[model samples]
Target: MPLILIIDDDPMIREMLITAFHQENYDVMGADNGKTALDIFRTEDVDVVITDIIMPDMEGIETIREFRKIKPDAKIIAFSGGGSLAPDGYLKIASSMGAQYTFQKPISIKVLSEAVKDLLGSCKKKL
Candidate 1:
């Protein structure tokens, strides 16, 4: 089974994603902040990362950079509900930072799941 790491400060969002991925038969892990997420990333064989852009602590952009440094080919999906900058602004930064996919807040779990599956399919092709 593929392992997915979900990082978000909002408990409800984290739980929602966890449950959705679980139903999809993916092994899921949750982190409330970028710092905690990175620690888990270092230890686990995470296939894809779904992270919120405006999280407290490390924030999503920095986390994406760190993930790239650790694994240049890491699969990442970034999302935001908007902050000082609009969600689009943050998502653009995430794309430049190597996030393969981006979404706005109130994301459809079905779409996110399809993105994960598509990303994994592409990864398999690369191997």
Candidate 2:
């Protein structure tokens, strides 16, 4: 089974993603903040990461960079609502920072799941 790590400050958002992945029969792990997310990444065999952009302790971009340092093969997807953060280019920056893709807020589970599938498919190794 594949392991997915979810990092978000909002408990609601974390819960929603957890439920969605659970429905898909994915093995899911949840973190309420980026620090915990990184901790999980370091300790667990995470296949992919889904993280919220605006988080306390460590933001998504920084998390991506750090995770890349620890696990260059880790696949990450950054997401944000764009409220008070960068007005634009959130996804672009995340991609530049090594995230496979980024998602705007109010994301559809179907779209996110499709993106996840596409990313995993393009990987050199099968999960």
Candidate 3:
């Protein structure tokens, strides 16, 4: 089974993602902040990462950079509302940094699940 790491400061958001992924039968892990996410990334076998952009204790952009350093092929999906910058701006920057997909706030779980499935399928093809 593919392992997915979900990073978000909001407990509700984290739980939502976890539930969504679990329903799809994907093994899931949750982190309340970027720092914890990175630590989990270092120790666990995470195939995909779903991160919130405005997290404290490391921020999602920085976490993406570090994840790239540790695993250049990391599959990341970045999501955010409006932070200091607009959601589009932050998600754009995340895409450039290494995120494979982006979602705005109030994301549809079905869409997010399909995106992850598509991305994971692509990765599987490459391997």
Backbone Cα, N, C clashes tallied per candidate: 0, 0, 0
Q: For model 2, how does the per-residue alpha-carbon lDDT over 14-90 read when each residue is reduced to its tens digit?
A: 99999999889888999988789888988998888998888888888888999999998788988888756562477
Tell me which of candidates 1 and 3 scores higher on TM-score. Answer: 1
* TM-score between candidate 3 and the true structure: 0.95
Ranking by lDDT: 1, 3, 2
Model 3 stretches astray by more than 4 angstroms: 125-127
Give every collision pair in model 1: none
Regions of candidate 1 where Cα sits further than 4 Å from its true position:
124-127
lDDT of 3 by residue, 1-127 (tens): 8999999999999999999888888899999998899999999989889999998889999999999999999889999987879999999999999899999999899888877887888676322
Which should have the higher lDDT, number 1 or number 2? 1
How does model 2 fare in lDDT? 0.84
Query: What alpha-carbon RMSD in Å does predicted model 1 have with respect to the real structure?
Result: 2.0
Local accuracy of candidate 1 as per-residue lDDT tens digits, 1-127: 8899999999999999999999888899999999999999999999999999998889999999999999999999999999999899999999999999999999899899989988899665321
TM-score of each: 0.96, 0.91, 0.95
Off by over 4 Å in 2: 122-127
Instruction: Point to the candidate with the largest TM-score.
Output: 1
